[model samples]
Target: MNKLSDEKPNTSGVLSAAARDARMTFGDKAKDQLKEAIEIVNATAKGLGISVGSTATAMLDIHSVAFGSGSISLHDETGIPLRGMGTGSKRLLTAGLHKEASKSKSIALIDEIETGLEPHRIVRFLKSLGSKDAEPTMQVFATSHSPIALQELSFNQVFIVRHDKPGGKTSVLAAPSDAQGALRATSSSFLAKSVLVCEGKTEIGFVRGIDLFRVEVRDKESVDAAGVSLLDCDGGSETRPFERAASFQALGYRVAVFIDNDRPIPEAEATAFVERGGALFHWAEGQSIEDAIICSATGSIVLAILEAAERLNPDDFDLLDSKIKSASGGKLNFEDAKSFAEMDCLSSEQKAWIAKAAGGKKGWFKDIGRMEALAREVVGPRFEDFDEPFKKVLKSIIMWATR
Candidate 1:
């Protein structure tokens, strides 16, 4: 203290050495590295979806410091010390220091990397900790439950650790590469207790709409409240949803898949997935979602759906005239589809033709918005009126979600 009190203290060249260390520490390397790392921080922080400040960097900084023994203050800035910084800033600054130390082949451990940091900040903090590098300069073992952290990292860099209470066994399994696609798209599901892998946007929307329905009308618990996250496979392939769900099973995620029964998955793959504790949910024999809904729905409900389709998208979605006409063998020439729903009730043949037509590439209810509305506003209200086969599958889904 007495030595630092002097304007030009000559305490064994400590001030000069400290100044030199500060320049060495926060000089070129920090400038370049911090510049690159801060760019990531700025980019991720840009879309936090919340108003944090005037800018991402406004509330953030890196100050040069001098190591001082017995002194509470190490930062060169007057009256501001390490303790004065926010917890998130201190954690980030620690990562930066560890990054520099890693050049010396140091080892580091950071538990709960998301603690004291926002989602966007977690991303940049990982960057500072050498996570963005192909290979880290030093070995770092980190544990995080943050979805952003999982999103920023590849499957190869992640491991799922589980402890089974029955046997008191601890297992650490490396995440499969296929799971990375789901991780990138729905990162938050990695933190979910159960994952429902849907075949495409239609299923995802259906699940979301059903959850909303159960919560608002049915007076039941939500799927989200039950720790079930719905994932979209984007209609990848015949086995796409199953393959991804199998990957999740490998990661020890309680996995389930909702798919169309029109295409049969390979028996061997299906058996293996089931053996791995994956739950499979699909429409009845040779039935797609559209077919199942139409088959189970009453004539009036089907009429309502058609009316909504005509009212909402009469031009594009109503182009199903040729499809319906072709399916009906020209027996029911429902021109323009505008006149189809004017009747009191459609026959079984008409219903089948409508369902088949709706399953086409440009089907009316094939899109997420239309499917969501179908589940939430239309069919969900008359849940008790669906046929036994459709009700069975739908009830199974409800049971799994609420369980």
Candidate 2:
């Protein structure tokens, strides 16, 4: 593999003796070729989302020819030197120069290709790397940590680097291209060995919270150490979970679906997922994550969560009583409130209201940042107070991830 790094662009030495000869002889063909080369560089830079001044020029001076004065200097749109341009622009210009100089049968390796580039520019840069009509076919291997770069790549072009913890062996696994279209928003998950497809943001927070707690208090490894990534699937959509799970499964990566019990996976899909060696983790039937947490967690843990919520959003809590009364038509104590909300007697609206109150924007469990802190400080030390089913869920996730 030929590595093409974005080192300092040496414009002076690039002016060859042949060009000086052509200039001295006043040969039309060589001058035309030089002009064509300059045009190609400018065009390629434009395609890579770089703005270059039209004043960019390469002139051969007869008097200073022996001193290597026949050189090219690039400028930005405002006629400023390329050296004075932003890093992203300079990198793009350097890339353009490399592409112009490349042969037909070339394999280019670029490290951190997305560095100093804006997210939107990443797509254009990728497109410019491919072979176009009349251009030589080339292969490009680029490394990037940008999600935008991942989104622009087809799954077949993507590989997840898996490092075995015990053996310290690293392997690269290719992702299938079938899910490329649907994965634009969730492409970052492809980097991990195993993915936990969460139903929504709240579920993401809870899982991350638990992970933080374990790492800080229990002196355990973080989820990242287990090669697990959590993806929020924007909840309540029945097909999204299955689609995402299938995407990862096609890539030969271990995947687990973590959804609310209230959202059931169709039997056929569930069976197919299991048949294909995927794992599924969900709450108890008829319960969302909030319900499960409330019903299963120890009373002290529940009180702590509530008290923490109150502390975080005092004004929101002040309005909670009136809102609860309007939704439930009666005042209920915190101990019985969640259970009552979970019962079959409540209407859909009432259930939604309860859900909002439990995990909405201003709800106790809604702030992922605070939840992370809580997990580290409070939940981590008292993790045993979490209900058995919740504990089982955590264990299952860890087991699946490590395996």
Candidate 3:
């Protein structure tokens, strides 16, 4: 470098006095280059039609570039990086990376396998794990409360842990066979000690309504608090309840069946279920659930129930009237159900026919929500106003729940 500091020209017109005085002694060695750059910039600003009197200034700081790599990252076409990926997507990506990176066998333990995944995605991700061929490639152990995740696994693959308060002991049992569909549909029942396996949505709604009535009017706790959970048989042939009940019983659950009397399950299966400590609850023979409930109602309550059902089925004109008329074999034919109100009253036999029509496939209150509303609005409020036998059957259920 040329040192002409003492004989430097009087170039104060090119720069201010402060700028001239600022460029002093050698700053060791490396800083001399920085000082030269500062002078060059200050000198060039004038030729470039720039003024140096503004608030702008420049300096060098070594510490500022210490962690510069933090700003460096690779991104996808849409400018999203690894940090921008969703948790579920990140997890799947990680699994895929592990699958490709590791050639040797490995063991993986994942907690809450359903975390950050949709139901269908969860199934697909799970199916990707474990053995690829007859010989195992990887082993996986996952914990989850999701029924969808559990449903994809077979019986022996799932283990349930239980605690016995009376004996101060714990037991781990494998899931039971023949219970995949039912167990997955009502997975919460697995946690309960008692399961009242009801036939279809109608029975489920009826029992739910009774539970509500028992709680609201009778001043009792809910069946849920009593460790009793209601299960649906998922509606199949007469043997579905028994098959599911037997499966739950094998899993150490106190099981019961609440079904219609239109078609009885095989006597041998019924006896076997009872012999295995199962409970059976049903209406008198030749009677479905609708028949048993409607035929037992008081005349005023019967009209109230009919009015509620008719109100709920307003879309179908003269619907209940047609069902009632056809159910009675033209003995109770009417232009509209409203005309039935003109009668002094309906006999028990006439109401039974109406009940039969209601239990049909296209009947009123066939849906779970509709049947649930029927119980809550009509049957639940008029609990004692129904026949004694109807009340007795409900009482049996309440006793079992509380016991």
**Candidate 2 error regions (>4 Å):** 1-36, 43-54, 59-91, 94-112, 115-120, 130-145, 154-178, 333-363, 370-378
Clash-forming residue pairs, model 3: none
Per-residue lDDT tens digits for candidate 1, residues 198-259, read: 98888887777777888898688899888998888888678778887877788888988899
Using TM-score as the measure, the top candidate is 1
Q: In candidate 2, what are the lDDT values of residues 138-194, reduced to their tens digit?
A: 678888888888877776677766778999898887776667754587877876778
Query: Best lDDT goes to which candidate?
Result: 1
Residue runs of model 3 more than 4 Å from their true location after superposition: 1-86, 131-136, 183-188, 191-193, 212-220, 224-228, 334-344
Q: In model 1, what lDDT does residue 78 have?
A: 35
lDDT per model vs. reference? 0.73, 0.67, 0.70
lDDT of 3 by residue, 57-157 (tens): 23212123332434333222233344455676556555554554457898878888878888876775675564233555567878887877766676667
lDDT of 1: 0.73
User: What lDDT does candidate 1 reach at residue 219?
Assistant: 89
Candidate 3 lDDT score at position 129: 63
